[model samples]
Target: MATISEATSAPASEAEALAFARRVLRDEARALAAVRDRLDGSIVRASRLVHDCRGGVIVTGMGKAGLVGQKTAATLASTGTRAYPLHPAEAVHGDLGRVRDGDVVLAFSQSGETEEVLRLLPTVRRIGASLVAITERAASSLGRAADVCIAMGNVPEACPLGLAPSASTTAMMAVGDALALLVARMREFTPEDFALYHPAGNLGRRLTRVEDVMRTGRDVRLAAPEESVRQVFIRLAGPRRRSGAVLIRDDRGMLLGIFTDSDLVRLFEKRREDELDRPIGEVMTANPLRATAGAMLGEAVELMKARKISELPVVDAEGRLLGLIDVTDLIGASPEDFEE
Candidate 1:
């Protein structure tokens, strides 16, 4: 039972400090595992309530619980469920109007007796909105008033003083996440649906389709396989920025091969300039790696990395070139960039 000053004043080795930190994390992890094991019918009931809700899900709490509720609401909203955070204190000041009939209100309070949270219950019920409570005690006032009560069983604080909320808030947040994700799964949420919510950041860049960023139409340099390399280069040379490769196609527009600036350099270095006047197909790389228009940019990047190529032709089901994906376009991308 050391005071804050006493704890700070005591000299502890790095090992001691690391051990203490590990203990705190272990305690919280154990508490979460306990909550997971003890989950009962209440979770099912809560999920059903949210899934059947025709209107948005309204989440509210006070203090740390409120912060967790806000994050939970955001998770739900981004995963296809309509949800928003309503501050309990603000609810009394007319913000309660944000709640409507058919909305499912989720209230988070470790104690289940938070005054501000309890004060808003009656109004939430009167609005014809169903109430769900996440608390440590299902028998507490907030639980009793709720249509469904999700109990966080006997979570002890990781704080040595047992006064500050620690393990309890962690368990509450975990439960909130579980509910949100379960509801998302019940609604059969897809990655496309997730992308719609997150259209910025690295996530957006990873989810972007090849067609979205690829060079198409006049921007693509296409040449017949029988065309001379010199003729192809002359046609491709212009003031506009260009891709490093030329797509070789047949009269039916089917992709046959690809000729790149690198190939031209190799030809000159090997003194094979005479071959350039022959059919470009004779020197071009045949059956090059390609992607589809609907494929993710990340996928095209992986293919390019594995094959050690800079350009990937985007084709349709019939192998007709739709566009080209350049490695420079995805220069900064990584495997982790595509993870949800």
Candidate 2:
């Protein structure tokens, strides 16, 4: 029996270890290139088959191949293909009834001869559905039975003994990703589409709009032209459950300038104690760069970065005060979604 010591001692030098890693990556890349070049008719047909499915693509495999199959199904589903996994063992028991004529069966088997996989092929065909097999040999049972066989070719195992399924699995994953991406491009899936599928993710929250995160109703920072400087200072600084600056507007629905903590401090530094009693219009910055309520979060960040401004006012299309978007709020968001 092989042991961990035998496997550990196989690669005698760091150079050999590095070479093995590179070899696996290079071979997998080559497999992807081959698939790309060969995507002429088979990929189109397979994609169309999945697209036209009345049910959805039912992916199946066994062992390590099953893990890869699960990921492939998810990628397909996320990228516009209606795909889900069906375990080989479970299919044989009773799940075979789930296979419909309008559905496509995508089977993954590195060896192409996995008994569990071979046993499901007849039942897959019995339902009058299409099968797209991803395997290493064209002559293998699964490969030959599939209506569209995507031969992954002979990817040499990274294991020195040719026992572990290293390069084969990587090649399968690459093929799956390539197909998912192509189908996504074909269907013109956008980041907004991805956001719908992945709403609980960080990208979803970061992509969320000013209307989603901004305060409204009684919690909003609002003011009027007749407000005194002392009240504006209290609203803009120190405490209010929210911070940065306060949004001020005239009674006519026109936006007045904002009064930040900086403006308050600067005013106190330059004025007499009695001068603090002046109206807020004296200290507020007039005509600040403002945005609309429906503006994308990404665009808002860009405007902030360009103007070197920390706070921005949100208004309606006709220029009515809506709310405020802060640099600190965007900073709390992820850096990924904010990038172009």
Candidate 3:
């Protein structure tokens, strides 16, 4: 009944278009209100099903609900819920096998009469999987067959003609987000845990480790405490390393402190210039911060930020020095790690 251009656009000024959008948002608010006011025993039962689901969750829908289902599936998967989207059409082909008895199925539809979604309802029940439905009418096909029906109360469609799907899809998305977040919180979903699921995103780098960025092997500044300031300066200042010479115990080769050219002025200011002749113990920082080789760099930044230090030594869990890190040295680390 409509041309491609007409389908793509509506004839109206920008202000009129904005008014239509406002009306749609109002309808969405009403839909959210209705869903909240009508929530009953079904919500508790559905939550229980989700809690018991060891095999994870599968959310399915048709039409607009199907698009919302994809976002819901992705959110749940990212938030430690182990969820995936199962298209109603694809279920008939072979995707039905993805659902096991231990999985929870969430079916969403405004009219609850989508033939694609309804067709999968019987097999979902026959397979012994628990089902939860979200729809306006409790007696709707999908609603009636569900193990638990979430009543989507009477919120008029955002379409002025009351034909297009708008508010219903928004309400369904809110419900999906609520369920995912509730379950994720119950499981104590931490940033570190979430990073495993989102390794390529900014969140993953925010949880990155010091070992991932610190200078390793030959690039690390390591030397005995007994080394001459001249010899240490040759190795440290010669290479233009951000970190100065690190002093380790001569006997066990364990880290003790660090000595930098910055310390030279202060030493010459207070004591004789010849005192630089002493072992690094007298000239180096006696109590330097040491980090375990595997500690998160984000946490290390917190330490450095609080202490206002430029560089720190990396040590093993047993307190043996492995390498060092500096704020300037952060350039070699992943770029995503620096994001706010």
Candidate 4:
């Protein structure tokens, strides 16, 4: 056994440490590239088995592979496939009841011989569930037992001692992701479908539609192009939160221009309080940037940022005003958060 100091001893130099880190990354990347090249009929078969299953996918593994299995299951579930992770150790201890007929079991074991995972194979078959094994060696027990075996192609471990699971686990994760994403593409999974599963993070905010976040109905500050600025301000003032800009529309309900509180301040500063009594169209911004109600909230945010504007109007095909999206609503949002 090694002491903490011995275990964490410094390398010859910082450069050597960085070189070692880079080598580890390069080794793992090479493993993934090899796995990618090795992908063949087995992957397609595994994907089809899971996709056609009447029951949800059950992902099972032991140790580090178990952690990777959980992530794989989560990715599948989020991408429109029903999936859940199962611990092989727990499955033998009565949790095997989770398996059911017509279900697909994805077992992860780099060497294809993890005892816990292998032990569950017979029970999985007994339950009438199909098994898909992901491993480096197709000749191993688990691989032979599986209905389909996805070979990871033997690769050198990133660990110097070749004891820790590094390159193999990375390849397994990459393969799992490939299968899930391919299935998603085959099912024509849409962003809306993804949003349904991820509704509580930056992803949710990005996927949110303009209609879901915009101020609509009476909450929208509306003004006729010909209405006096004074009249528009009086009508817009109230206990309810008011948008910074008032949407100016024509009698036919088509958007004409936008008048903001900033315009009012400018009027006062210019000693043109008399303009407050003038038609609001005289001081309003005409042909402002706008979004459709069905447009993504992130798209609206991007438009606002690019145009250096604080408010965006939601309109219909005929330019009818539907609602308003305020910059304050997007205060905490970041551009990177919206990238797919």
Best model number under TM-score = 1
Q: lDDT per prediction?
A: 0.87, 0.76, 0.75, 0.88
| Model 4 TM-score, all chains together | 0.92
Instruction: Please give, for residues 161-207, the per-residue lDDT of candidate 1 as tens digits.
Output: 67678898999999999999999889898776776787777888777
Off by over 4 Å in 2: 1-9, 97-101, 231-240, 250-256, 272-276, 298-310, 327-340
**Candidate 4 residues 51-135, lDDT tens each?**
8889989999999999999999999999999999999999999999999999999999998989999999888888999999998
TM-scores of all predicted structures: 0.93, 0.81, 0.75, 0.92
On residues 39-63, what C-alpha lDDT tens digit does candidate 3 reach at each position? 7777667766776688878999998
Q: Which tens-of-lDDT digit does each residue in 44-139 have in candidate 2?
A: 676666666677889999988988999999998877678889999999999998889878898899989999989998888888888988888879
Best by lDDT: 4
Q: After TM-score superposition, what is the CA distance of residue 5 in candidate 3 from its true location, in Å?
A: 18
Worst 10 residues of 2 by lDDT: 331-340
Model 1 RMSD, rounded to 1 decimal: 2.1
**Model 2 backbone overlap count:** 0
Clashing pairs in 1: none
Of candidates 4 and 1, the better by lDDT? 4
